[model samples]
Target: MPDHVWWKRGVIYEIYARSFQDSNGDGVGDLAGIRQRLDYLAWLGVEAIWISPIYPSPMADFGYDISDYCAIDPLFGSLDDFDVLLEDAHRRGLKVVLDYVPNHTSDRHPWFAESRSSRDNPRRDWYIWKDPAPGGGPPNNWISNFGGSAWQFDEATGQYYYHAFLREQPDLNWRNPDVRAAMHEALRFWLRRGVDGFRVDVMWHLAKSAAFLDDPVNPAYAEGAPDNQRILQVNSTDQPEVHAFVHGIRSVIDEFEDRVLIGEIYLPVERLVAYYGDNLGGAHLPFNFQLIHATWSAPALGRLIEEYEAAIPEGGWPNWVLGNHDQSRIASRVGAAQARVAAMLLLTLRGTPTIYYGDEIGMTDVPVSGEDIRDPWSLNEPGIGVGRDPQRTPMQWSARPFAGFSRGRPWLPLGRDFQTANVETLREDPQSILNLYRNLCALRTEWKALRVGAMKMHRAEGDLLIFERAVDDERLLVCLNLGAEARQAELPAGLGRWRALLSTVSARNAGNNVEFEDTVQLHPDEGLVAVLTA
Candidate 1:
């Protein structure tokens, strides 16, 4: 295994805290439950775990509307429980990365409460507040990410405060030096507690335009979807000033040794790479989210890979994520069979790969009805297929009642196929997606070519996406079939043979030698990682 930068060479598993495991029968997962599952994660061979927010929150936007930065939410556990989770994770050789939300705070937060108390309050500048326009409405045309105007009218103060999402969550005025200092201290408090690192949430929103300018209209905006799509968000996000704030954040995290700082930025490829900073001092990896939102086509994905790789700074590392709490699961997006093929593409790519929890066992999104929906984004816009509760359902750990996630009724419904699609059931099946993930993880540790190799060539041929990763004379080729029908593919060299390291279809064994003069046959939704001499 590579030791210099474990984050760059190792696979990361993202866990949604509320749905991971429920220990105290509360139906909601907590710190203690996560501790009990540490062994399972370590056994799965992930180097690190990026847990969603566990800080004190109002649950308005779930854990994202944090009321306290340094304290653990009672629903999750106490601070002591968090310390134990961290200690146990490190003891098992696994790193723990917390989700850091520096962009906004719950309206119930003391800072926001104090800032909104009165227009003359000392902390009034702590949050963005503006007098109503002459026409008696929002200060600007900015729209809330969750729908409605971004500015909320404060009755007592007679001023409107900005909120990027729900009115219950107010955006912090990061331009204030005090706000910066306080947020930095919040980071230090965790670093002192021995947390490995942080996955900074909305890292690009740390700064906004000083002028409070109205965002230009989005010409591509379509009706009946993405309520905020009417605006392009030119002046509201990815501001030039954000890089400097990111530098300060980088400096603070650099104080601690061997700690990783990851940023969550959702911008185009050209602008996304800017988060790496002028000299690569920004985010260690500013999350390439293209894969999550891109079309699942070999030709489309092939061009995406080349463009993203080309846009990355020379020294900046890259990372890939297939699914997360915010989106639909991979299995549901591209059928169960294709998800296996996706695993090979994600793991073999020339960058760090993050496997969303439950995806390892081919978990699909559980249907969430309107009354059962928990996501604010979905509730704000009904019937738009934007509900996230389907993907945030409880993990299927076993065949036990409620998938063994909780003794009490679960907070959300479990997948209908949890009886067959579970860790315990699939752990014994060599052909299962769970075992496929295990083998791919082991493969990464075994081959340096897949870890730190240069991506020499990548191309799309018909329904197949082919790529090569090479280190010195060691070379590994990854070929994936994106369609449901079998296809014949030609090798670039016209004549070559390689030993199959692993196959998504479970057709090839370790010693199986696949040879071809020019063309090779691939089964439906098949992908393979094969080793050969350079």
Candidate 2:
């Protein structure tokens, strides 16, 4: 394998801009604050940083509802601040990837404003607008992912516009050539600004069924599922025409040298692999989220890894994500002990891993009361459990007031455990989760077998999961115990001797050379990487 593709062999750290750091005591993280912390990230050893949306917005869906695609929001700072960030990050050898929202725009955007003005407006076709049904109801029974009807009626024009999310975020009509050209131009605008790439938001939802049809009702939806789950969404998402649009976007990205395009797709593994396109023309990485949704068990995770590895198309590189702005933290999902196993699993797997900001220090979800809920999905569809404010709380830097995230009150409340979980506190402890993550990253950088080597499952039974990563004569074994009780894995024939390189249980013979004859015992929730003796 070639050694120069930065995104393929290196790790990427995701920064939720508003929650990362606060400059000027504003309680909101900005480009300036991120620039101030570049040194810390450089020390953490990530090769690239993928920041959440920072475009000019009305804060409807936080920054996802973009009013202007080309400018930075004042809440995050001016365009000059972004330029300095890009320049400084390059100087430190970090590639910057910005979040690109192309499926929809804020209702206040100029295109949406003109499209909603009158029936005969020149820009009326820019957005998806349709007449009400025969009974004066919404055109169809489609439900928004956030909640309620996907159609919002306009009394002035005697029509309704379709929005896949909040009423404030109107879905753009990609069928329109003008809209396509405009969106492509927006991509070019940032490429010229020297961004390394884009993580396209809701990439699969860009194209809809040409024939407007109501989605089929899902028979398996449970009582507590989100309202949107009531329908199968077959007609509204992952349409056949979406691949052509992906190719169009890829064509624009190809104009820039060495830039990557990563898509945020929530489809199944079978459908997700298609986003890579034929001959690798689609997204550079479509983002495999199987691990995030799988059950927290060794058997389930082992099956998921096998399925994902089997699904990748030829010439397509794989990627993995454990947590992000939308999902619950891994620590909260599997408990503190298993989170170390999770870190080892993420870094040791044969793919590029994207680490969420606070995960390195083992941050848990902050509790959000009804009054403090900032996510529109949680507010609109109360009791469905779709709120994201808990996961998007400010980053904890120190044990000072506001967890050293800000001088003023944070936009969202900090977790109660931030005092002990902050970076300052964890950095001093040798066995802390932060140190384990640092060691894992360093191991990936130092060993070719751990970085780009092929992976093969050696043993997977009950709570024990074992895999081998090898390149030519060098081989390494990864053993993880996901259950509460200790387990022993019997060695296979002719495996030779092995030495412990690193262990999740920090005090357990770490970095010690050992010779195993027939079996190796693993503590509960512990993981270890061992090198084979020649």
Tell me the alpha-carbon RMSD of every candidate: 1.5, 1.2
Error of 2 at 365 (Å): 0.8
Q: Per-residue lDDT for 319-352 in model 1, tens only?
A: 8999988889999989999999999999999999
lDDT of 1: 0.89
Please give the CA lDDT of all the candidate structures: 0.89, 0.91
Give me candidate 2's TM-score against the actual structure. Answer: 0.98
Error of 2 at 402 (Å): 1.0
| lDDT tens digits by residue: candidate 2, 86-159 | 99999999999999999999999999989999999999999999999988899988899998899999998999
Ten-residue segment with the worst summed lDDT in candidate 2?
Answer: 509-518
Error of 1 at 523 (Å): 1.3
